[model samples]
Target: MKKRSWFAVLSLALVVALVFTVAAGCSKPSKQPTIDKIKKRGVLKVGVKADVLGFGFMNPATKQYEGLEVDIAKRIAKDLLGDSKKVEFTAVTGKTRMGVLDNGEIDMVIATFTITEDRKKLVDFSPVYHVDGIQFLVKKDSGITGLKDTDKKTIGVAKGSDTQDRLAEQAAKLNIKPQFASFETYPEILAALQSGRVQVFATDGSVLKYYESQDKNTVILPDKYSSEEYGVATKKGNDDLRDFVAKVINNMVSSGDLAALKRTWGLGK
Candidate 1:
């Protein structure tokens, strides 16, 4: 009788212990330190571009950021935290993306960040989320075919953009020095070109797509270079976080989430 009662109490205690353990496991993600941190904080901080329309932009209508990068970040947030709304977005630019990521102002950057040898030195990159390339945006009938035709003509690119370096490299190959006009943002460069302040908007084709769609008079010069592999970025030596992000990206690609997003944004190859 007494022995049966003792066994019943012991069984109850063990069942309670098991329940708490399972609950703890549910509340906290196991393994990766970065994943654990994110779970503890209950939110993911992501850096994204605010000016580029298709890639990332703050929609004036909703007062919320929207676009491919934003969609990617939201999907990742949903996977990590079980809710897409568990994300906080910070606007980053060509000049500030790496700086803000390095400063820990954001846990990850999905801001059309092109993977490059130089950028690899500063931070780690997840598997490529999008494949883009650099191209020249010129006016219709402007007679600019490629970099060889620049001939010291003014080319506009965002300040701190790798486009400047790419243009210089092309200039070296062509034996011509091209003049460059720099703006602080991608939209500003487009504005400069539209207003005839610069003859060309030379940057990523993914970015120029917006203006090309809006204005029929503009044309992409039909020359593509610098095969840009856009990746999510994390701080240097953050291999754990990088790996986790890479897994999320892989899942997104596999589950057709990313492909659906590309269609939603009207992003084509």
Candidate 2:
């Protein structure tokens, strides 16, 4: 009877030990690294422009995204997750991208997000990936050739974009006060331009090109100004992710892969 009691106690201890061993094996640490979280989730989330063709546009017929920025996001995913298609893209506009990033709805933003001192306070930016300039799109028959001709004309710019402030500063320098109208998206600005609700549609020159291609009557002004340095944006305090993104961008720039993407998208200047 004593021997049977000893065996029962031993078996109970062994079962307890096995339970603890299994629990320890399955347990995760209190805090996991950002990369590990992404790996476990099996998808890298990125915000990109849905309307800006060549930079980031969603092809309606194919229901897939294809653009330079989209490719960049995919490249990042490929390096981190070992598969380019492991990325999920969320469409964002100038007015909404930052909000989404701040809310943790996206891991990062690859939209044509221009780096500015004011924006730096909100999020960290990767190295300048692309350089662009603000330009105008107008009907060829509008008789508006340049900033000098835009005095008192209504200019359409995206809400929460740097274009408005830059345009105002330029207008002040030229001593020509152009009235400004703000829209939520690039497409809305283009539509306002077509409907004559605003005399000019203004944003980054590359973005204007896509709109111009869509409308045969519209022409982009040659007066490109306000150097807009585009960068990838990561959430504030996300140093690891930001550093990784910077490394990837540096590699692309060095290997001429970025230039190749630019040429493929007709973004090469």
Candidate 3:
């Protein structure tokens, strides 16, 4: 009888030991770095454009930023932070966008940033969200059909934009010395072209179409300077964040939300 009691007690002790071990293993802390800063701050800082039409800009009457890119950023904030209203918009220009992202001024950039090998070296990009091509915008009466006809004309482009690089490369290839007039924003470039400050405007074909829609007298040239893919940009070395953003974007695309947003914002190709 004593042996039986001893055995029972020993078995109980072993069970307790096993339970303790399992509990310890289960209670181990997660290794992921804390994302509490965003929650505690009660805001998700997002970089967006204030001048680029259809992509990011403010509604004059409502004084709210509304655009396809802005909507995507808001959706991301909603998924991660539980409320779309938590997004705080920061106006960023092409020249300052990457710098602001690298300095941690914003958590992510959804400002029509193009994905390129050179930009990828400084920041991580989510999956290709939109496809575009560089094209030329000219006056309807200019009779300029393509880049080949744009000899010695003043061309307008946003400084620090991918279009600027494409224009430089195209000029180099064609051995054309086209004069360039750099603008601070897309609106300025459009204005410069419309006001005759520059004879031509070079940018993504989609953006050129947006401009042409606003002003019926503008024409987009048929020749494409280069193809580009747009993506969400985050600070470098944030692989986990990049993966999360990419998953959300892919889901958005698959579920037709991205297409709907593009149509609503008049960004559809």
Candidate 4:
């Protein structure tokens, strides 16, 4: 009976040792960082505009995405993983990109996102990737030359957009009250502008240029009211991802890749 009892005690000690060995081998020392998580997944998820030509747009004919912002996102994936196609593009609007980025739904955002003091409080922005300003789009035949002419006239702006704020400031400064037509999407704004429902379609110059390019009758007015600084965005406190974004953008700018991309998309001088 004493020998049997001793043998049972030895087996229990051996089992405990084996269990601890396995646990130690299986456990991680700490949680994985954001970069590691992206690399492991083998795909970088990016948020980009689905409309807003020249910046981020999906070509319906080819059923493919193309634009300066799309190129930036793909370049980031290529530089990081050595493959550009290893990325997932999520269509995001001006308002929705922030929520997904804040919730970690996307790895990064290259969606013509403007960098502002208020936005900086919610999420981190990379160094200025591009600079654009608010401009106006009007039909070529329309007599409206600038903001001064719009006295009680209707102007179209995207809902939940930075342009809305700029428009408010402009109204306050000019001391002119213009009716506002708030649309949910850029296409809707374009439609409204084309239909003459609104006398002015105001947004980023790049976007306004796109609208002008599509039809000769549509003219992009020269009134650039506000300077907007565009930046890549990441979740707040995501220093690692922010650093990665900055490095990619810096290299692209130095190598002239960004310039080439903009030229291809018909943006940037």
lDDT to native, each model? 0.86, 0.91, 0.84, 0.85
- Between prediction 2 and prediction 3, the one with superior lDDT is 2
RMSD list, candidates in order = 17.0, 14.4, 17.8, 13.4
For candidate 4, give the lDDT of residue 117.
96
Per-residue CA lDDT of model 1 for 1-269, tens digit only, reads 99999999999999999999978754553344777788899999999998778778998899999999998888889988999999999999988887788766789999888899998888899988899888999899788888888887899988767888887897888899888888888778778888888888988988888778777889987788688899999987667788888999999889888888898988855
Full-model lDDT, candidate 1: 0.86
* Model 4 residue pairs with clashes: none
Q: Write the per-residue lDDT of candidate 2 for residues 109-128, one digit (tens) a residue.
A: 99999999999998999998
Best-matching candidate per lDDT: 2
Stretches > 4 Å off in candidate 1: 1-32, 214-216
Candidate 3: segments with Cα more than 4 A from true spot: 1-34
Per-residue lDDT value at 122 in model 4: 81
Estimate the TM-score of every prediction: 0.83, 0.87, 0.81, 0.84
Shift in Å, residue 249, candidate 2: 0.1
Ranking by TM-score: 2, 4, 1, 3
